[model samples]
Target: MHMQTKKNILFLFAAGVMLAGILGTSCKKDAAPDYGIPTITRVAQPLDSASIVTGSFTQWVIIYGTHLGSTQSVSFNDQEVPYKTIYASDSSVTVQIPRAIPKDVTNTVTVTTKGGKATFSFTTVIPPLQLTGMLNEYTAVGDTLILTGANFDLYGLDTTATSVTFTGGSTVNIAGGTASTLKVVVPASAQPGPVTVKGIAPLNISIATVAWYWDNRNFLFDMSNFNGWNGKTYLSSGPDPAPVNGPYFKVAKSWQGGWAWDPFCSNNCAMPAELVNDPAKYINYALKFEMYTPLNPPALPLKLYMVFNSGNFKEFFYDAGGGSYPYSTGGKWRTFTVPLSSWGNLQGFTFSNPIIMEFMLKDSNPSQSNFSICNFRMVPIN
Candidate 1:
């Protein structure tokens, strides 16, 4: 009719140009993706940073290698550490830090993750090298003193802190270091009281420098010797005797022939027999007795004979007869803590040279046994 209506308009313009080239090849294969500029990974800072303690603990950090995940964050010095409590599959972290971080310092640690940000600068936490002022009351053998205070600047008086020990063979020779002072030389079988300074090496790795001393009021002990046990003096061996209660202190089953005071202290058996004068002012004080026995007692081999000041009784035998104060849950109430420095030279005996600490309990496995002495105390620990 008009050439068949222009051949149906040229077949609808070639089907609209084949549907616009198939929507431009499906929008160039579903486009939308640039994602660039992002690739960082840095994390390494942990040799065990902060230190110094008077009390309270928890400071362990390792953070070595291997896919450290969990979108991290740990900074301290630049702030923003918001109590970071994390275990995170063990990349290691305990961080509680702050007991002493002074003296010529430096401390910084940043760790932001997702593969980015890492910084480290450490050193600073020194306050436990204090060997206070002491005017000496008695320190035998070639005595040469003067061991002042303030971190002694890593103490190197005579090459790695040359000499200082006293348990009976004495040795002291630090002769050096002076900003505050430290020039020692008291080595003559040194004994007599208070001279326990410490620090061999370790200003890092959580910190360690304990052994400072200077409170030698000459073997401290007061409150009229804790009001009881008659001016102190009671060892055992004559019919089970070494009692005190009102402050708890006992160990009676004597040991010559008696055997059975452990697990049978008649509830307040006169308060363990009385004499522990709670004079709390210890420089390193210690005394905690606890006993328990009877699984089949009566002699499987047992012997306990205690005597101190009965003539300096071997200077306070800590353990030799058998029950220097046994503890393994035999009857119950078990808690021994004797550490008057193990009574070397009869530690702290001075109510005018008075000391009589005793205890003796034996059963020699004969099968007629029983034992018990629940609690006793004389505390102070650093």
Candidate 2:
């Protein structure tokens, strides 16, 4: 009986060991597949497959490489970029280089994935085309425009490609150029509006539209040129007025007093006759003028008013006491640019006709105020 029990115990122990081995084998988890280290082969545009050596801000880029689907992050010059996972695949990924200023040093594009990380060298570029000022805002056909700014093809190597364009789709030839300046002719077909300069690669900059009514004898009222002023009743000759150098008109008023000036349209004014009949042309146009206030009265509130031909008008008030406007009573010239659109709809008003501009003091105190006016004209905004 003892021998039989020992045999039964040995058989049961062997059976238990086999059952445990089967359960262990069935429950064990499968090992994950390995994706090799990521490698970047080429960077190109998705549509044309054209290789890209440099990239612009917000430009779409496709990166061709191996093991890219697992990428967790991408960056430009250590700055992490936002990307879409749906555009990524095992062999490639589509992304946009962040819209930001490029670093001075060499730029590197990096991709990180569960498999590994990869990097590629690239050149980042930004086109900065800003037009600071023009030598002459008003120019006749075939006249020259001196454009001042930075990042122009100053060497004039590619004049045909580098050009100045007008709103009418007319392009002007680049006569000369420098790093900070460009000389371009006003094409005969060019209309009076904003101008754009095209630079090499990605640079394109535009400036405010050229002035429609510029500072000339017909439009400007200065101590030297008083043709635009209505009369001399409310105006007096400036102090020791020299013809070319002194202020054109000196206006004096006591409390609750004012004066008016009307533009002289019969003179050599350059405003187009068509603009007077069409109020649409008045959009984006502004009246710009320079004013100098004497420091006699420390602070004085002033009100400016404009009356249109159709009996429509608008008023802009400046609180001299609060320094609301940037004018100081220290006899310094300050240019005020007031947009015509500030007055509501001007559909039926005739803009070319004589408009009355008046300035009056708002203060109740019995104090005298004096203001000098110069260089009044109309300029474009866009």
Candidate 3:
């Protein structure tokens, strides 16, 4: 190694380092991006990708724009909603509107990113207060008339207001309610027709009802009205929770006797043309009745299936969807519906001819049994 060669190498390396430093100084690196002031274009729903200017609280929506990839906060009408990083991106933030009732509704969706805050014109509205159905249409006076649906709480139904009007024009406030249910005692005068709900946003709403409060449409027989083929040995009046009709077919048996058809059978009876004409349509018709099984002692809280039959068709009642056998209402005179589709035999067993509708107890008993039931009418469920 020559000393001159070593000196030349050191000089070349120094020159290279100085040039690199000069270049680095001249070409400055870009400052870290703060994704300057987020931008929002339009909001849309995830399904069908439909653009929406307004949406229900708790509904999911996509906020479209730039700088959202670093979203620090997302809110619908100023109400912050929780979101996962996985569902957010620079161009979009997918979030659900907070269910909290809107107070000072600004009607805008806001997004805040590291850069700044941006907002799009959006209205977070309360879901429509819907009264789907009365749990038991024949709810007795002073009995709780429970109506089920969504957004009962959001509506903040001014119960004292004329929010709930019954069939007979009797307006009552909701006594109790949750998100999906509104309960009012059945007014002694409430009739049978469509009920009215005046306390809603934008416009008052009308709630359609099934047969209501002692309404007998395709009238079958009750204990007070049935063919006396089977004597009313078990006909009973309340001190049950409540009673809808005058007398109900309460099983006043040692129920250890189990399985028999005497008290439940109706003679070869005729049904309304609607119920008899199209057997295929029977699937849409429900056999509804007020039923109560005392859950406490002496009132045998046995799980029993309400075996019912019309002609050769045989089935039982439980949940509205049908056939939850060895079943009990647990308690209360709630109406029970058994879809005839469950009675596959009825699929073939329509009454172009006369037939017998009978009720029987199952041989399988919880050692003791008692259930009060009445108003067995076939009503259009659809």
Clashes of each: 28, 5, 1
lDDT of 2 by residue, 104-202 (tens): 445777788889999898776765655555544444467677666554542232355676777578876678877676677777777655676664544
User: How far out, in Å, is residue 49 in model 2?
Assistant: 37
- Residue pairs with backbone overlap in model 2: 154-177, 154-178, 222-248, 223-247, 223-248
Regions of candidate 1 where Cα sits further than 4 Å from its true position = 1-104, 110-127, 130-193, 196-357, 362-382
What digit string (tens of lDDT, one per residue) describes model 3 on residues 1-382?
Answer: 9999999999999999999999998899877976767899998988857788998866778888987888888877757877562267888888887887665788888888888899888877666666666677777679787777776556655344436777668888877667787778778788776666556554344455554555576545545665646646766677664567778877756544445443444444556587667777887776667777665544433333443344355655334323433345567667665666765566665654345565645454434446677777777767
Q: Which candidate has the top score in TM-score?
A: 3
297 in model 1: Cα distance from truth in Å? Answer: 20
Ranking by lDDT: 3, 2, 1
Tell how far residue 267 is off in model 3, in angstroms.
4.1
TM-scores for all candidates: the values are 0.28, 0.42, 0.64
Candidate 3 has an lDDT of 0.67
Candidate 2: residue 106 lDDT (0-100): 54
* Cα-based lDDT for every prediction: 0.40, 0.59, 0.67
Error of 2 at 300 (Å): 6.7
